[model samples]
Target: MEPVLRNLRIGRVLNEIKKVPNCMLLDVGCGFNHKFLSTVEPYIAQGVGIDFKVPNVSFRKIRAIQMKLNETMPFHNDSFNIATMLAVLEHLEKPKQILDEIARVLQDEGKLILTVPGKRAKPVLEFLAFKLGIVNRAEIEDHKKYYDLTDLQELADQSGKFEIVHHRYFQFGMNNFCVMKKI
Candidate 1:
């Protein structure tokens, strides 16, 4: 993942967050640095970041854990008020199941905000990664799928755990931003 592009995705997600004081947040695939969590620390009361390689430690109001997203999550039900998966949905082998887990851990009507490469980004991302050498080749190569708005909506629908609240294409339509409310 390119740093600028990852931050762009994070920015788009940030716009969707409703500045709720004391928000309990769950950030999936927060990477080793928890950059996004760091940025949103002020608005949230506390946060938990889960990733395959996150440092297993606790910060002031944030916790980082090494957790495999493809498996079941470790938290109890209704553990979070907001959950985010910035640029992460497409990397999962079991996207639907992961979405279900997100729903399961969220409080009723909690928001699940996520981003992924939109369908139209495929060729451009490939060109950037494979030819231009701008994006991370291994990262783009690892993506299992690209999603469109309908794909996201359908995934949310199929889980029967979320309702589409908002969605759009950003980054010049190369990326998708979706907000689903837990049902």
Candidate 2:
């Protein structure tokens, strides 16, 4: 399959997988596009993809379904070795709840990977749009939250369960990438 945004998102996950070996993996908010599945294919023992919108299950190869992120993930306790929340947290109303759920389903030593927009990207872009009056901040559905380095760190640190292992600016050229790992 040709690469796209989903592929880009999954690439980040695959980069992190090199640090851990032979693990079960879950991709939260994996959509019908399944653009990123190929990245994780070779490394993960088993991969489960979940999203709210129904994705084309036929091509996914891995297990997938339509499910809400705010609700419970349908699996046993400590079901996965690693869980990735790529570009999904900023869209939710209650991101903390989802983080809590991720913690509950992950093994004590399991890892969680999170990526969101960098601090200035969203606000600067949105502010540019506001000047033109072409977009309304409230109407922008996908971005429910924005984070600077400090705020993102706090969110990951105070998750109630997970400890922040690594935090840094993930970048692809001029674009900013915010990467956080659950410890």
Candidate 2 lDDT trough over 10 residues, lowest sum: 172-181
Give the whole-model CA lDDT for all candidates, comma-separated.
0.88, 0.68
Candidate 2's residue-wise lDDT over 114-182, tens digit each?
A: 767665557554764566555545434468776656766677667867766666655443123454444
| True-structure lDDT of candidate 1 | 0.88
Per TM-score, the best of the predicted structures is: 1
TM-score of each: 0.96, 0.78
* Clashing pairs counted in every model: 0, 2
Q: What is the alpha-carbon RMSD of candidate 1 to the true structure?
A: 1.2
lDDT of 1 by residue, 53-103 (tens): 888989798899998998889999999999999888989998889988998
Go through the candidates in order and give the C-alpha RMSD of each one to the true structure: 1.2, 4.1
